[model samples]
Target chain A: MNTTATLSRIFAGIQPELDQVDALFQERATSGLAILNSASMHALASPGKRLRTALTLLAGKLNHYDFGKLLQLSVAFEMVHLATLIHDDIIDEAATRRGNPTVNALWGDKIAILLGDYYLAKTSGLIAEIENPRIDHLFADTVATVCEGTIMEMMTSGRADLTVETYFEKIKNKTACLIAACSKGGAILSDATDEQVEFLHSYGLNLGIAFQIIDDILDYTEDQSTIGKPAGNDLRQGMVTLPLIFALQEASQNGHQQQVQALLNSDEHNEKDILEVVDWVTHGYGVDLSLQEAHNYANKAREALYHFPASSDRDVLDELIDFVISRRR
Target chain B: MNTTATLSRIFAGIQPELDQVDALFQERATSGLAILNSASMHALASPGKRLRTALTLLAGKLNHYDFGKLLQLSVAFEMVHLATLIHDDIIDEAATRRGNPTVNALWGDKIAILLGDYYLAKTSGLIAEIENPRIDHLFADTVATVCEGTIMEMMTSGRADLTVETYFEKIKNKTACLIAACSKGGAILSDATDEQVEFLHSYGLNLGIAFQIIDDILDYTEDQSTIGKPAGNDLRQGMVTLPLIFALQEASQNGHQQQVQALLNSDEHNEKDILEVVDWVTHGYGVDLSLQEAHNYANKAREALYHFPASSDRDVLDELIDFVISRRR
Candidate 1:
């Protein structure tokens, strides 16, 4: 399958931006660097797509805010995201992350928890050091929102009858809020107008949904080794994802409701049983519909970027729509 | 034995201040109140000397600054402290606190952790609302430091030879820093002069040290029924307190170091054996001397407040010095 050309283009464009972000993290993260080196290094060196940081950089550049601090803002958002994952692993009792022993698995829950707090506190301190109280306020509020979102997610876990609306609420808080904060924060740092910030926020919000949906999709389809996690980990944990949401509805009407429910409740499902469910969704038009929904979100994100003046940055952000919807890994 | 009349006066002074602090907690702790209410209420209802809040208010009033939002700070710090205890119970595998089932024992460690995070986030949000970024900065740093301190305490838990210097550093961060922050933050909020703020910080620091030493003393002298925790808990956990530090040094010089070390390292020590050591210390001159050292610290704490204007608030502050050291339950 052909990868999105825009992915490479955006990657090339943000190389300088990534270097600046690394430098800023190095400068501010000195006090506890030696202590936190293992956890922090593992978190930073993970080979994520860097979609969130790219959004911040592109959003800032689109608003004519070309500066070094955008990279810092990118790193700040990424660090916040990393901190959440560290805590999430503890909550999830996850053993392996990105193909390595989880922090809690290696260092125990206490250190993992403290390391997460350290990163969060360090992020706030770095923001405060920028001498911009506005940024500090927004960053603190965003982190608080992230915590609230996590609480909500925990509150909803193990509920089989959770609605799509509630799921939207969870994902909005869990993922979109920070993505929106990233774009909005970047725009604000660039002194973008309120309308521009709002637009970028909407863009990031929709993009985040698409990104998370793709993550859910990849859980079923990607190589577990490459993904650094087991396949169907969410379903094993009883997490209802987009495909399950759609398939359950379809199966209910098709007289396979009991079968689908049995599969969900059963821990003994063999590979063949799982493959049947995956095949049913992949061949029955649900996969196309789900991907199309992600594309629609990408389109909305592109529309949001139109509010800004046209620039190569804006064009790159527009291409992100295609990049997000089409990426295979 | 008659307790100090000065402590009774300080308790009376804190009654009104506590009402104010309780109201602030009630006003701001909107969400998770139902889940947290029992723990928070238990903490609120379970009586401590309320010395920290008294120090906060007294420091403000002594500097002739209005106690603007200082009550909120008081509630936040105390709640944060309580939250740590809840999580600490889980880490320590404790079942009871203040003669009641701990949050972890009652609701389980999972809930305890989330509830702890909830309160911590609430405290952060509350501190952010204090209209001064400097105080917020200090509050955030103090929380991180406290976590670091506890983590260090846990890391060095089983070691019998933990240094006096390291123990001082840990207690300073875990217990004293917050107390010092409360005093300094109150003074800062009240527009106290630099010298006055410094004086309050020193007072709080010295008081915190004395407070902790007294706590250590009570662990040996007080009964389990009165203390609401097992007597000699710290020693049972192999923690090196001031008395143990003193006894160990004395034992070392007397060539009985191995005996003391063997007692601490013993996998099996009945309550009788435990009390034998306790009785030896109490009947020995070492315990009295250690307590005398604690009293010395308390006197120095009162001395730190001596330079302030001699108002009733200052008198209440002086009374608090005796009350903290006098705690038996």
Candidate 2:
């Protein structure tokens, strides 16, 4: 089955709740300022997978699913994700996201930055209404970690000496922690046992790691038409991801290390150099090794589901692992 | 007395608590990331007036002053202010602030943006520790207003038709809202009565309006050596503040309106054109008129204090109103 078909099947049980999340998000994101309202509406038009929202709702389903609280949690987490994506586009200086013009592309960077902050503030307001200190602290620490990860990424840009360990560290903070927070927050909202929250958090964390690893892989393996971004875009930005790190390790033994290092360390990346590095990673063991690592995490995520009983929600979450690993975009 | 001498006297009662706020800020801002740590440390080095911190501390002193919660509130609010400044400098493309190089100037916009996010995240963490939903909602709303005001400013930039009412709305959101949040947050931390909280909020709001009006006036009246930024800096950026607005109104009747309008609405401002507009606003009734408006807000601020009984803290708060209006920089 295709990705959308699979996601529809997985989320069918919570479709009504998901629709409400979208409605609430749109309602909350609307502002009195015409420019902000229009810019934000444009941004909302090109929606991502809403994976975090799904995780929150699904995790809440495993216990007491108060639709009201879960809706707030889902919307807030998704808004945080959206806010980060907007800011990330500004930092990446990318004109397109999901094959559509980015907020920064349509408006200037100043508006984009403020829009991101606006979303964050909106997220804070929603979280405050929830009035759970544990959830509040979880979301706060997750955001802080995400910021730290972004800083680390910026500081490490163009440095070919990045280790696989550090790469994992960066992605964990950048992507995984927030995903974990979503699952954990939903569990907290549902008044789940601490053990159940921990289980869901672990499930989300491992799943998130797998999600990002596949994302890095797709950056090299898929074309713009397939992935909604140019192939090897990360390499063009001098970002050394897991595949690149693995490729460099393999190239060291194959005598291509110096050339790759020189290309990456240069002030600007030419298309030729970016393509060459992409070829090296794609045609070598890098993608294969990274895929294996992703599978390992995917397996961990699958195992985490066993901690919960064999409910329909757990079944969907279990299928989500396969979807995350196999989705093209 | 000098501005510093007067401020010292006003803040003397809370010197030790102020010291602790500084220490805690420095401690909290220190990060394991070397780049972020050094940049944040540099930002902390050239501190602002810490007027928000003083307002928070003094407001808390009016009732129960729990040192721990007040410290957290003060530090969190100040960090939010610092975060906004960092992002604002990026928006303004400013190289210097308070006679010191900005984070964007020292590192780059990317790092500066991330650093601002880091501070905001740090602020959320501190506020979570306080665990008060009311304070959290107040801060979140304040930040949202601040972002709205900033976006309003950006949208209105280079438009010569900005009105005085819109100008007041802009400054109220951009500056006064956060200041109001600080005082209200302090009152909340102190467990003050609802009436006292409203009074403090009103006082901070009026005081903040006065503060920003003076700031606008200073931009025209003070040179680089005095205000730590070039005179007419706002005009150079096409920011039509109160002084420029008042001057334009005056020039409309005096037959110099077209020239000033042409100068302001132009694509780029030449130094000569900037100086010409500055001369008109500074030499005309603009400065005097703007100062009178600021004093009006100052009086409102002072009147807000009459609700509280006479005490040293209230006295200090009253003196703060005078200090705000009379400060040269």
lDDT of each: 0.72, 0.89
What would the per-residue lDDT of candidate 2 be over residues B1-329, giving only the tens digit for each residue?
A: 65666777788988988899999999999888999889988988864547889999999999998889999999999999998999999999999988789999999898988898888889999999999889899889999999999999998887566789999999999999999998889999999999999999999999999999999999998897777778998887878899888877877544565666687778777889788888889999889999999999999998888899999999999988988999987
Query: Which whole-number lDDT from 0 to 100 does residue B286 have in model 2?
Result: 89
The complex in candidate 2 yields a DockQ of: 0.88
| Model 2 ranges off by over 4 Å | B1-5, B253-255
Residues A112-199, model 1: lDDT tens digits:
7777766666665555445555666677667666666676777666555556677777787788889888888888888888898889
- The ten-residue window of minimal lDDT in model 1 chain A covers A1-10
Off by over 4 Å in 1: A1-9, A30-35, A64-72, A253-286, B1-11, B32-50, B253-273
Cα TM-score per model:
0.89, 0.97
Second chain only: TM-score per model? 0.90, 0.96
DockQ of the two-chain complex in candidate 1: 0.38
lDDT of 2: 0.89
Steric clash pairs (candidate 1):
none
TM-score for model 1? 0.89
